[model samples]
Target: MQNEKDIVIKELNAFLQGQYMGIRAYEHLIAKLEDPEIKKEFQSMQQDHRLHAAMVSERIQTLGGMPVNNEGLTGKIQGFISQMMMPESTENIIKMAIKGEDLYGIQLSEEIVKGDLDPESKNMVESIIDTDRRHLDYLKNLVH
Candidate 1:
């Protein structure tokens, strides 16, 4: 098994890569959304992702790893799906975005429960998870 530092660095890098991917995917989704309110919420989500991405990247560097700036494999697949699928309707767009958010939250929750992070790192992940929960709630309420 990898050591604590290695595991944390890998997790943080994965988180950063995921956030960047979400940012790009959301931007693509935002353009197709016709509702001003929905578009505005997505823009807010994009901003939050950007903030998280920066935080994770900084943490990765602090852990003696080079921060990843390019899109990772998952990001590439997501980008491809978003572009190729071409969500034609607002409902489709919401479904796609919500699905991505749900998966991200689930993955983060698992990492948090694994109990490998140092105190500061754990705190950061928890805070981000809280923000993610809020975002998911808002999206669910909006869709209903």
Candidate 2:
């Protein structure tokens, strides 16, 4: 039987992990990209993920739970796979980013709809979701 605080902490930590994954994925993509403008945009999105991670970690600490500092095994595996599978083209990278953002947005939406988060956490997640939608839109535009 998990208490409310514990549940909230778990949710926040999961979100934080996702942010870490985003940061890493962006770094990988940015390193492969050649266009200055595209690289700059990816860097900006990566920074946003960093900010999101910090905010979520702070909230988790406020709830008396330790935030996860790394993206965990799943993230590592995914990163490895991406490194092996990713194409060199800018369009392909952007398309991959779009898929990631879309998936993350769905996950965030599911968390919000679950109604387990405290008001502050829910608000924060909502804000993050909005940023993710923008990121998704930007990536889609770059590929299209």
Candidate 3:
């Protein structure tokens, strides 16, 4: 039977994978953006994603679980294409992605914190959620 630690690790691993997907998507979106400022915001968000992944990795290790190494084929291919394409319009792309990410961040945070999860897992999720809030705020400012 899996222990509580093991169960938490599984959930953390899944969450990490989602963040990995977000990072790649943002990177792709960034590549298509033309505005230097908006590009910078995307880059900042990408850094946050990396930090979130690192936090999850730490928790996984703490729980004696091996995290997944790859972002999977679809994420890699899509990220590659997004990076390769020159964005036709910076405003639209940034706005769309920012809204999506903001919504995702809020939803994920709520789920992680309010759901029936272990204490350790909940704490980590909350921490990541805090970071996401900051990212959302930054992106919101860009819209104005």
Task: Judging by TM-score against the true structure, name the best candidate.
Answer: 2
* Candidate 2, residue 85: how far the Cα is off, in Å: 0.7
Model 1 lDDT tens row, 1-144: 788898888777777777778788888999899999889999999999899889978888888887789569877986887799878888888888887788865465556536677777778877887788788888888779
User: Which candidate would rank higher by TM-score, 1 or 2?
Assistant: 2
When 1 and 3 are scored with lDDT, the better candidate is 1
Q: After superposition, how far is residue 17 of candidate 2 from its true place, in Å?
A: 0.6
- Structural similarity to truth (TM-score) of each candidate: 0.88, 0.94, 0.79
TM-score of 1: 0.88
lDDT agreement with native, every candidate: 0.80, 0.86, 0.73
Clashes of 1: 0
Residue 104 of model 1, lDDT score: 63
Candidate 2 has a TM-score of: 0.94
Deviating ranges (above 4 Å) for candidate 3:
71-87
Model 2 residue runs over 4 Å out of place are 105-109, 112-115
